[model samples]
Target: MLEEKGIKPAVVAGLSLGEYSAFVKANVLSFKEAVQLVKKRGQYMTDAVPLGKGAMSAIMGLDRQTIKDACEEASILGVVSPANYNMPGQIAIAGIKEAVEKAGEILLEKGAKRVVPLQVSGPFHTQLLEPASIQLKEAITAISVHEPTLPVVSNTIAEVFKDKEQIKDMMVKQVMSPVYWEDSVRTMIDLGVDTFIEVGPGKTLSSFIKKIDKTVTILNVENEKTLEKTMKKLAELEA
Candidate 1:
């Protein structure tokens, strides 16, 4: 719709599974393929971890190294690592429930401002999701992927995907690797993306992008109202 007004994304990206949407926008995956692949991806992840065994938590106001050290210390209990680096002072950790809780405690003791546990199905974006990665690789390989019409940033490596061939491996590694959202957003800024539009249901990405770089224009389209507002903002930017 924005294209009709001579506006389009300079580069595309999303958080976690949201990456699929970025791929769709970049023409790496057709809308239909994205839907089917996402469904199977969900199924595989559910099958990978039993409910209550895995967990995630948001550790706020802590440095990356502090959080990493806490997770490493807590790994004695089970798998635990930094799952998502959401913003400057906020990072999410995931792994076995025991380890996550333990890491949270350690982070707090280490002077973290807050360690808030998240209500999630299973420990995503960690080694716990390895099974899901393997399954997703096969599913993605079955599809007809094309090189991106525009750059699509990857969450795992915090870099733009190269071509059709990189998608499967990137997707496979993504499931078990931490999402460098903060880094990805920085990469976009370096790419000269002065504006961002979060085209989904929530403004979480908008919030993170704002934290990463306040100067960039951020917009969202979740409903009719937001779409109208976003278009108005884009029009003004264009003007």
Candidate 2:
């Protein structure tokens, strides 16, 4: 739709699984290859950790460093770490079930306003997913990748991917690395991205972007109504 309307983004980025969409949009991976790769990737991740062994939770009303420290403190019990820095006060932690539970308690004790456990299949973006990362590396090695037409910011380093040869490695590592969402958004803002249009099913990303920079224009298109609304809004902006 953006193409039909002659709308071009200054930069492109995605969060976690959303990165694959960015890759497809950037022409780095074909639709077929992306589907095959994502299927195997999902399997590898599901097999990496047994059901009921791993868990994830959202930590609200806490700073990044404090959450990191809480995870580090909880690590003594088992694997636990900050998984997603979603926004200023919203972060996700993932690891062994026991450790995650412990971390949740610690976070609340440290003055966190709330700690809610997430309903996820397993602990993602933690060292426990390293096995999945390894498998993903092997799966992607057989596929061909091209340099992105537009820069795709990585969740691992919060940097633009410049080397085509490194894309595979970045994707693999991304499976086990915390998503630097806030940092990635800040990087785009630094590059002068004043408008963000999330092309997905939910408004979760838009909410996060708003928290990061409320002054920026944010829009999401999930259906025809939203699409029309967003197009009208963009026309107004352009006018």
Candidate 3:
């Protein structure tokens, strides 16, 4: 689906498993390696916490500070913390079920537009996932990772991996750090990337990019038809 579109991402970024895909695209690892790493990551994360003990929620229409305050205000029963800072008004918070629920209530009371609970096994990007992060760190150093052909922005800092050592460290930290998604998109724009092609299972990334900059040419390629269309558009741009 990706190759057909000629939408080779100049700077590939991913959200969770999407990071594995980005690594594969960047030739840092083979397809088999990517799959193996993700599988191991999933297993480690799952084993770190008991099943049904953790959860995530998307609190929209609220800024980061507001959401942070809400999480801090509602930090009861379990660890509620902001996971992914998707955009100015969109953030995903993760922690124990009760803490997440309390945070959601506080946000809603404070005029948050909506709080949607995510279907996830563990509280990703939180201290609750530190055990998984530690285990994953060992696995990352053990694996063979090479520099990407182009800049690969990390979710944790929204910065491109410029140093091999940083790349190695960021991989582990990303497992338990808030994804600086908004900053990443902004940085890409600042670097003159007017076009964004999200190659994945859904159009979520593209949607977020649009929210970041409506004028940017953003497209999602999930099937043959979209792939063909994207290729045609890319060709036109080249012409």
Candidate 4:
């Protein structure tokens, strides 16, 4: 579909399972390989953490440091830490159920507009997910990963991973580290990428990209209808 539309991505990045898709799109690995890796990631994440013991929450209208301070003050018996730094004032925290609950309470006390708990199988992108990282590392290292044709930012550091080895290491660490998505979007903007095309099952990334930078042209392709619209947009943009 991308080829049919002549929509060449100048900078492609992804989140969580979307990372594997980005790799496939970048031609670093085949789609089959990427799917297999996601299966492994899903299995490892589920098996490493017990159900209902882990949780996630979004703390809106708070700075990163304030959220960090809140998490530290709210830590109870289990692990809790910031997971996804979505945008300037939005961040997702993840860890033990009790810890997340405690953190939410602290955020509310801090005058945060909203603290909403997320439905997830595990406390993703936190220390609690380290075991899954270790397991996934072995599988990822076995695959033949190459440098991306376009700049592909790492969720772990919000920087473009230039080397294959660095990409491997960062991929493992990303399982247990916060995704600096806000920083990533800014970085791409600094690099002069004024357009973002999100191709996947959901429109979540496109929404975040718009929230991060409304001035940039954002197109999301999931179904055939959206694909056709995106093709038309690409033609107009290139013309």
Candidate 5:
């Protein structure tokens, strides 16, 4: 659809599961391979933590270092660490249910405006998911990956993938590493990206981009109405 409208992005990046989409767009993984890999990855992650044992929570209105410290302090209870550095004040922490709850309390006491628990299957992007990461590495190694036609920023490294090997390695590490979303967005901005079009079912990425840099144009295409609106906006920008 974007090609039909004569729109091409200079760079591409994705968050969490969205990274697979970026890989597909960059021609690094075929649709079939991506689907198969994701299926296995999902199963591995699900199996990594027992049901009711893991949890995740969103901490808002707190700086990154404070949240990190809270997680470290909560580590005594069990595994707990920052998961997604979504934006300036919004971050997610994941780990054992007890540790996550403990960290949330600490975050609140440390001046966080709000801490909401997230309903997720496992404690992702933390050491607890190391088993999943190992499984994902084997799964990824079984598949063939190609160098992207355009640079694709990595959530784990907050930088463009250097080569196909790095892409494979990062895909594995990303399973157990915090998503450096803000850094990735800033990197794109530094590379002169003024317009960001999120092509997915949700507006989460668009919202994050808006919070990251309000000066940049943000658009999302989830349905026909949004697609038309985005097309008109793009036309205006091009004109």
Candidate 6:
């Protein structure tokens, strides 16, 4: 649909599960293959840890170092680490349920505004997901990937997919690594991507981009209404 309207992105990226969409957009993977692989990937992640044993929480109004220190202090109980560096003040931490709770308490004492638990299946993007990442590596080994026509930013390393050979390795690492969303956005802005069009549902990424850099134009295409609005906005920008 975007192609039919003569709009082509200079670079592409997405957050966590959305990274698969970025691979498809950059021609690194086909849509069909990504869909099929994701099913097995989901199973691997689920199998990595038992339900109710893991937890994630969002700590608001705290800097990264403070949160890191809190997580470190709480790690003696169990594995705990910062998962997603979403924006400046909002960061998600994940690990064993008890450890996450412990870290939340520490952060609270250290002046964090609030700690909100997230409703997710497992403690993703943490060392706890290493088993899942190993299984994911083997799963992607059979599939063939190609060099992307355009740059595709990665979550693990807030940088473009420069090496096709390392794509699988990066995917393996991505499963158990923090998503550098803030750095990734800065990388895109450095690459001269001033306008961001989120082609799928939700305004989450759009909101994140706005917080990162209010100077950029952000749009989303979910339902027909949003699609038409995005198209008209793109036309105006091109003019």
Best by lDDT: 5
| Residue 96, model 6, lDDT | 99
Query: Candidate 4: where are CA atoms >4 Å away?
Result: none
Question: Against the true structure, candidate 5 has what lDDT?
Answer: 0.93
lDDT (Cα atoms) of all candidates against the true structure: 0.91, 0.92, 0.84, 0.85, 0.93, 0.92
Task: Please write out the lDDT profile of model 5 over residues 42-156, one tens digit for every residue.
Answer: 9999999999999999999999899999999999999999999999899999999999999999999999999999988999899888999999988887898999999899988
Q: Provide TM-scores for the models.
A: 0.96, 0.98, 0.94, 0.95, 0.98, 0.98
Which pairs of residues have clashing backbones in candidate 6? Answer: none
Q: Quote the lDDT for 167 in model 5.
A: 94
Q: What is the lDDT of residue 148 in candidate 6?
A: 88
Q: Write the per-residue lDDT of candidate 6 for residues 23-100, one digit (tens) a residue.
A: 988888899889888888899999999999999999999999999999999999899999999988999999999999
Tens digits of per-residue lDDT for model 4, 1-239: 88665657887788866777778878877888888888898999898789999999999998888899888887865789999998767899999999899999989998888998897888999998889999999999778888878778777787887887888888788888888888888888998988888887888778888889989999878889999898888789989
Tens-place lDDT per residue, model 1, 57-118, is 99999999999999999999999999999999999999999999999999999999998999
Task: Show the lowest summed lDDT stretch of 10 residues, model 2.
Answer: 1-10
User: What tens-digit string does per-residue lDDT give for candidate 3 at 1-239?
Assistant: 66643446667888766777877788877788778888888998898879998889999898888899989988867799999988778899999889999999999999999999998888988888889999998888777888787788877787788866787788788888888888888988888889998876788888888888989988777778888887888788889
The per-residue C-alpha lDDT of model 6 at residue 219 equals 93
Model 5 TM-score on a 0 to 1 scale: 0.98
Indicate the residue-level lDDT of 202 in model 6.
88
Candidate 4, overall lDDT? 0.85
Winner on lDDT between 4 and 5 is 5
Model 6 CA deviation exceeding 4 Å by range: none
Q: Which 10-residue span in candidate 5 carries the lowest summed lDDT?
A: 1-10
